[model samples]
Target: MKNILVLCTGNSCRSQIAHGYINHFLKGRNVAVYSAGIETHGINPGAAAIMKEDGISIDHHTSNHVDEYSHINFDYIITVCDHANENCPYIPSKNALRLHHNFYDPSKLEGTEDEKHTAFLKAREEIKAYFKDFVSEYFRG
Candidate 1:
């Protein structure tokens, strides 16, 4: 089984969304999906709420340090946030295919509650739509 890792700065929003999307859409497809952050902490509730709208739950996912999985081999290690993409240069897997799919930090949104939730929804939608397209076009049978 091939392992895929999606990364961001916090592992809370974008990367978590990515992990959920890939895991749900690609379930039983013989691939392992995971996510992490360069500096992980504080799993975001806004992200969880938005994902629930898509019928994807991320409540159990916690922020993860990139170093936690440094020793594992990955088929793909994609950085989905700009800060993480810029900072993540040395992923451990020599056989891994490195890619960048940058997404904005929805946690940085400044506005009302619904507005913040909307930001989370927008990011989640983008992650789902783009990843669904990507997997169907490239990884599906």
Candidate 2:
């Protein structure tokens, strides 16, 4: 099985959402998806809530620092935010393919609860579309 890592400035939102979709779409495939942050910022409630609405549960996931997975060999390392893509530390995965996508961080949205929900929904849909295509192109049998 191939191991994939989705990274972000904080493992709270975008990356977490990507992790959920990638894993969900690739289930029973030859891929294992994990996510982490340059610095752990705790799992964002908005991320979890939005994912649940899509019938995916990420409530069991915890915010993790990228360093925590330094020991594992990753087949792919994907950065879901610009900060993580630019400031990512060196990970010693021999043939790891690095990819980047700047997903909007819904946790950063401010305003009424409805506005925040809309932001999270938009971000979630974007993530779902991107990763769905990614899996079809790269991991489909």
Candidate 3:
């Protein structure tokens, strides 16, 4: 089994979005996807709502701290935001391949409901595209 961890400043948004997409894309494959943050900010409601729009459900996902998975050796450690990438703690996984991409935080936007929704929609699509390419390249069967 392959283990992958997604990291972010807060596991609430971008990391959670990536987690959902990785799981969706790798379903039935021998892969386990986990996401965490430098600080737990709880799962973002906007992230869940946006994922649901694409027929992916992340409602059951939770915000978690990076230390929680210290024991598990991850095959990939992915940082989804600049903050987490730069500030990421050292994971003891000897061979974990690290990947980083700074996705814009849609949750930080303060705007009218429609605008906020649009922001989330855009982020979701970008994340979705990224992970789709990632899965194809790394998990091709």
Top candidate on TM-score is 3
Query: Where does the lowest 10-residue lDDT sum fall in candidate 3?
Result: 93-102
Q: Give the per-residue lDDT digits (tens) of candidate 2, residues 12-79.
A: 99999999999899888877788999999898999999999999999999999999999999998999
Error of 1 at 49 (Å): 0.5
TM per candidate: 0.94, 0.97, 0.99
Q: Write the number of the candidate with greater lDDT, choosing between 1 and 3.
A: 3
Expressed as tens digits, the lDDT of each residue in 80-124 for candidate 1 is 977898898587797788878888678999999888987887888
The local distance difference test score of each candidate is 0.85, 0.93, 0.95
Which of candidates 1 and 3 reaches a greater TM-score?
Answer: 3
Runs of candidate 2 with Cα error greater than 4 angstroms are none
Sort by lDDT, best first: what order? 3, 2, 1
The C-alpha stretches of model 1 lying farther than 4 A from their native spots are none
Compared with the true structure, what per-residue lDDT tens digits does model 3 show for residues 1-141? 999999999899999999999999999999999999999999899999999988999999989999999999999999999999999999999789999999999999999999999999999999999999999999998
Tell how far residue 75 is off in model 2, in angstroms. 0.7
